[model samples]
Target chain A: SQQGEEDPQALSIQEGENATMNCSYKTSINNLQWYRQNSGRGLVHLILIRSNEREKHSGRLRVTLDTSKKSSSLLITASRAADTASYFCATPYVISYGKLTFGQGTILTVHP
Target chain B: EPEVTQTPSHQVTQMGQEVILRCVPISNHLYFYWYRQILGQKVEFLVSFYNNEISEKSEIFDDQFSVERPDGSNFTLKIRSTKLEDSAMYFCASRGRLRDSYEQYFGPGTRLTVT
Candidate 1:
């Protein structure tokens, strides 16, 4: 399976603090994406880092991809209470018609 | 910004009954997909549709599952017979036709409870 596995299943932090989540996958991938999901809500795309690209950033979210290690990380700088959500790492297979394989996700809780 | 929309935010039905979940993907998008996530489980892919036909489907999408674009705007997933294990949050997603556009926008999801 090409499913990504995320570490630190859950994390809790205070507002203004930085939070980092890591993901490791088994096989090669075309790109890795990060998505945020609030409880019982739809997934919101955050960022996508191609295999050739080592890092990418969007606003407060920073994503890093290391193809050599088959791992990726997401960092949210200065998180706020509203930032609390489950962060998932997903990879799309070149042959899967853009269908995404998602990880277990990291549950983030930012306290005010 | 266009987004996918699904009907019946929550549905409860008896096992063995047929259920059809409906979705209207982003207007300009050409590819559509279905995914499900059981409570506390990873989201799993079910099927992908393009050009009004199934492009690809996962093993989970068996004979019991079928997808159709009944009209120009609506996409539907029908389960022949629902089992207790079929209960889950089903999400509909879509992406633009651009070759490089791989981002899939998802709907809020329909929570199906099979009793």
Candidate 2:
């Protein structure tokens, strides 16, 4: 079984600063995704990076995957207070029916 | 921008009672799933449904748990007997049928508190 573990469990930054979160997994995966959950709310998809891809960008999010290390990182540039939430890294099973194994998550608080 | 919809933003039940959490996935999507997050804990996958049947399920999905797509557009998760540990936020998610499409859209989630 593969599981993702995120580092620096909690982070606090000022608005407009850069926030980076790291995730490491235990097994191989075809793709890794990042999701954001506001306090007590459902998760919102942030970005996905494939095994072959080193990096991917969507809006202000930058996700980097390093298969050799079985790790990935999510960088949010120009952060805002709205970005205050728990960010989780999830890896889909190799068989792919979209069953995701999620990380413990990084609790990021961007202060305005 | 179609999204998954779940009923009863919050549910309160007593222990040993049966509870059914409902979700209406995106109309065009073919895969549906249920996940739960305990307060202050990580989100955990419970089960995945596709083509009118469960494709995969986690060990947490035990004999007390059951899922059904009784209609073409609705997916439901039933707990035969709820326990205090079942208290958590239950989320419903769905994605398209493409082999390479892996992005899952999640609903607002239902907060279940078993007393």
Candidate 3:
């Protein structure tokens, strides 16, 4: 089952602008992770936020989790054209230790 | 930096035929996973392997699907009978060890086409 579902199926922004994507899951999660994928390429792990942690950051990426609301968001500040890709949120099932359920993903196109 | 690797970037098979997708995870990683994504669809988890046995599997991982660590470095996902609906991009992932901050590294993925 697909637990996480990203909003704004697609997004487009100019270079240097900020881009934000949101994801909502249907059940409890121990942690939520964000990943990026280039066209026809493998997924790249970006940042992960545990259920106890409200927020986390790495480089230009900022991820926030609202466990109470079962929602999370990924923000890319000062986005560059190179950041163009699909972003997905993944979470392991509450009862399944290592099985990761991924979101539908948001396609972001950073225009130069 | 060690990274996971997969073989036969693309595989084309006829329906009902058997197919195997191979992956070589990071040398020191202990957990291995298999996932698949249909074109323009979300990535779905199939199964996870640890201690040379399956730790957990998703509903999508039916009896037709099986995983094996044929050698020290090779992890493979075999489909007993391929179906046209089985066509998708299969990905292999691995993580170093169990920890609060562990992250899974993914391979380039093998594009499977079943006719």
What digit string (tens of lDDT, one per residue) describes model 2 on residues A32-107?
9999999999999988898999999999999999999999999999999999999999999897588999999999
| Cα lDDT for residue B87, candidate 2 | 99
Give the C-alpha miss distance for residue B94 in model 3, angstroms.
Answer: 0.7
RMSD (Cα, Å) for all candidates, in order, is 0.8, 0.9, 1.3
A best-first ranking of the candidates according to their DockQ comes to 1, 2, 3
Chain A TM-scores for all candidates read 0.97, 0.96, 0.96
TM-score for chain B of each model, two decimals = 0.98, 0.98, 0.97
Fraction of native A-B contacts kept, per candidate = 0.88, 0.93, 0.85
Q: For model 2, which pairs clash?
A: none
Please name the candidate that would achieve the greatest DockQ relative to the true structure: 1
Model 1: per-residue lDDT, tens digit, B1-115?
7879998899999999999999999999999999999999999999999998999999999999999999889999999999999999999999998978999999999999999
Regions of model 1 farther than 4 Å from truth: none
User: Could you give candidate 3's per-residue lDDT for residues B46-93 as a string of tens digits?
Assistant: 999989999998888999999999888999999999999999999999
Model 3 over residues A1-112: C-alpha lDDT tens digits?
A: 5475798899999999999999999888888889999989899999888899999989999999999999999999999999999999998766654667888899999999
Candidate 1 lDDT by residue in tens digits, A1-112: 8975798899999999999999999888889989999999889888889989998989999899988999999999999999999999999987768999999999999999
